[model samples]
Target: MAARLPLDLDPPVRQLRALLLGVDDRELIAPTPCPGWSVATLLDHLMSLAEAFTEAARRGADAGGDRPPRPPSAAHLSPHWRSRLPVRLEELATAWHAPVAWRGLARAGGITMPAPEMGVVAANELVMHGWDLARATGQDFAVDPRVLAALVPFLSAAPAEGTPGFLGPRVPIDPEEDEWPRALGLAGRDPAWRPPRSHDVPTVRRGSREQPPAARRA
Candidate 1:
């Protein structure tokens, strides 16, 4: 049998990091696609989720414990958040690189599941929220097919109305839609919906394949 490919968090991580670098402090208060979550709030949530998933990779089932997660807010954001969040996210990608991180069971967001499954959830959070930030701040966003490939199976099995609190209701789309729109729709985001300032985003490849001249080997 062929070896199952290790789920790569680095690609999504790099995309998010690039978006993070461009965010201005003035834009922190801008509203994201997630209801009531500002860019600052979402960035804080990303930092916390990164920490949680990295711990899941390190400690397996013992990671999240039983503490109720505090609701994410801009107030929880540190003055140094611009630097801190990316570092934490980088560590998240690094932790998952260990083979043992993908074995046994893991816990995150106060729920436990197989480590492999949780890893997919982590990637989903990255890409989905990456879209949230880019849209909120009126920036272009790109995603690699491999990242969506890891998420397709799980999203395909998700409920039609979507999971409350985790994801909202499904957005309708045409039957022949490509994987990108399909993925967003399954995650309860409207593919056609745009922010007041949103425009056609110039494409930037978020893959590990041929990259822009300045793209780092992430």
Candidate 2:
């Protein structure tokens, strides 16, 4: 397994923080690529994950088997989230910067695993969700190539199609496409997916609205 480097995480953390800070109240209620989560709900989830992973770093591998706290809900949104989340993101990044955090095992959600592997998982979550928010709000999202390369192995190992909590069936992509599209494709997201437009809704054909003559005769 490829070990995650602390520097590999820095860009995504910074990007996610910038994205979160740019969100306005009107955008908070918007739906994201995450099936059931709105922008606000996703932010809450990120905050909880950051806190849990930070604690995991502090506790290290030998800290007895204890699970991280449950992720917070959309209702947990507060006036301070815009300020608080960035601070938490920084804390998460800083904690992992310690070389010791990458050695040995780490406990998260009561499961102890190699610290480096968990770090990759955290990085994947941050980058993918950053895309989710950007796509939802019509903002440009670009991941650093180094970060994308680091995450490729993890994306390649994603669960098979139809797995719960994952995006729909994987969308095949041309190898010639850009790195981000290829990465998104392997991660089960459609590289071409765009937010639905109100005018794009399906319309009934004029004559098709009535039963066909063949059906009436039958």
Candidate 3:
């Protein structure tokens, strides 16, 4: 039988790289559905988070602990995200995915679910934002089923109430299917998104709460 791909970001990075392969490097610098982030900025943030998570996962694996810290704030990350973004992302992904005994150790601490939490987070960024990037730049993209499956629980997870923008609409769950996309739909990010032929990205309509400005990549 073929080797089973990890249903997480380690393998899914291949999918993200493939989505980006044909697109112009310049489009990486354009504006996305995200408000303050230009495409370049967004890509940098995604890549940065992937790298950061990988490090955190490594730490978690090594010590059998919870996740590492969030990536440094956007203000601190902006210069590098714009300049050395791709290189950093590549390095981090590679380092984190390296073979190590810590892989199994990460689950021992109970900080994340078994089988690497960073992979889950990475998978979401790659799958969803790959679609966002494709839509923003007019490239075609498709989400992997494994990636989507991982997001089901991530979106259903709730932050404390009054957590500002994190508290999105309370979309009901089917309990039988994944919750992320449905949550995205409730957030106006599902099938409604369409890419521009040239430079204009589509705007999201707010249904209940005034559509807050698009979130900046962190």
**Against the hidden true structure, what lDDT does model 2 obtain?**
0.76
* Clash pairs for candidate 1: none
Model 2: per-residue Cα lDDT over 111-180, one tens digit each: 6888888788778778888898887776778898887887887777776583454345667999899878
lDDT of 1 by residue, 112-187 (tens): 9999899999899999999998887766777888888878788888898888667778787787999898889889
Q: Estimate each model's TM-score.
A: 0.86, 0.80, 0.56
Off by over 4 Å in 1: 1-5, 197-218
lDDT of each: 0.84, 0.76, 0.52
Which predicted model would earn the best lDDT?
A: 1
lDDT of 3 by residue, 39-136 (tens): 66556556656655565556554443454434333344454443354455565466555545125544322245544555565556566666666666
Ranking by TM-score: 1, 2, 3
From the highest lDDT down, the ranking of the candidates is 1, 2, 3
Q: Which candidate would rank higher by lDDT, 2 or 3?
A: 2
TM-score of 3: 0.56
